[model samples]
Target: MFASPAYAQAAGAAGSSSGSTIFMLGQFVLIGVIFYFLLIRPQQKRAKEHRATIDAVKKNDVIVTAGGIVAKVVKVDETEVEVEIAPNVKIKIVKATIADVRTAGAGKPAND
Candidate 1:
């Protein structure tokens, strides 16, 4: 039964248990920061820009819905918009569902 003192000395030189825990926590924090920048921030920015685009909708602006329906805006309300997908046929849609707004251009064709 030989228990060498060098075994205890080797264990002491390996690493601190608390330091490994702190390093693991630092890794988690770093992952969170990367996710915030890579996923969360860009999505919020796109939402903000889309909101701005929706709010700026006006009569005669061409807009495409999230459902891929391209229509010309007939009337703009606070929360709803009137869009004509076809001649003499208009439908009301929520403002948030509007995906893109094309500004009024010179002699742009109507949805009719």
Candidate 2:
């Protein structure tokens, strides 16, 4: 019962501080934009370029497989390919298993 009117003034300041909820939401949105540009966008672009390279593969291309086998393309179809790894040995593998392609100008490998 001895409290003065200053207690009522402090309660008014506390009510206004709750208005910063909008500022907190803006901060979260800013962080999300930064993460997308710095991390997510680059990863997606690299994956898209890699997919384009894989889809453009043709016959006579030299390629390295995921299993570390280097071979020359003997035949190519929609989803599978025949790769000649040795003089007379050819193995059939799925197209998705190819990890890297050696361009024509890269020169003939030692084994070719």
Candidate 3:
């Protein structure tokens, strides 16, 4: 009973537009999944590793701070670290603020 050409044209147009919309939505979801797997997941994993590194800190380790300060660990606690940025110059910072640990044997004065 397809007598009205105008009605058929309108139905076709609506169907095509709906299909395009669904295709766009699927594309967006795929992109989001790819981003999570390729970008967000790796970043989160790296953050977890960095946190573990900070938690395992011990004295005499060489560490770089988030503020770009390089210091040697004088003391390490559950929540904080005392770093000797220079001889006889110790500063306390949060353990989470440490960016990197250079080595385990670092900061130990010779002959100790």
lDDT of each: 0.87, 0.84, 0.84
Alpha-carbon RMSD, each predicted model: 3.7, 4.1, 5.3
Residue 75 displacement in candidate 1 (angstroms): 0.6
lDDT-best of 1 and 3: 1
Error of 3 at 74 (Å): 1.1
Candidate 3: tens digits of C-alpha lDDT, residues 1-112? 6679888898888869978999999999999999999999999999999888888888778888899888888888889999888788888999878889878655443323
Q: Per model, how many backbone clashes are there?
A: 0, 0, 0
Mark the regions of model 3 whose C-alpha exceeds 4 Å error after superposition: 1-11, 106-112
Once superposed on the true structure, which residue ranges of model 2 sit more than 4 Å away at CA? 1-13, 107-110
lDDT of 2 at 57: 77
Q: After superposition, how far is residue 10 of candidate 2 from its true place, in Å?
A: 9.3
User: TM-score rank, highest first?
Assistant: 1, 3, 2
Poorly placed runs, candidate 1 (over 4 Å): 1-15, 106-111
For residues 31-92, write the lDDT of model 1, one tens digit per residue.
Answer: 99999999999999998998898999999998888998888889989999998888889899
Candidate 2 residue-wise lDDT, 1-112, digit = tens = 5466788888887897767777888899999999999999999998888778778878888888898888888888889989888888888999899888887666453476
Task: Show the lowest summed lDDT stretch of 10 residues, model 1.
Answer: 103-112
**TM-score, one value per model:** 0.81, 0.76, 0.78
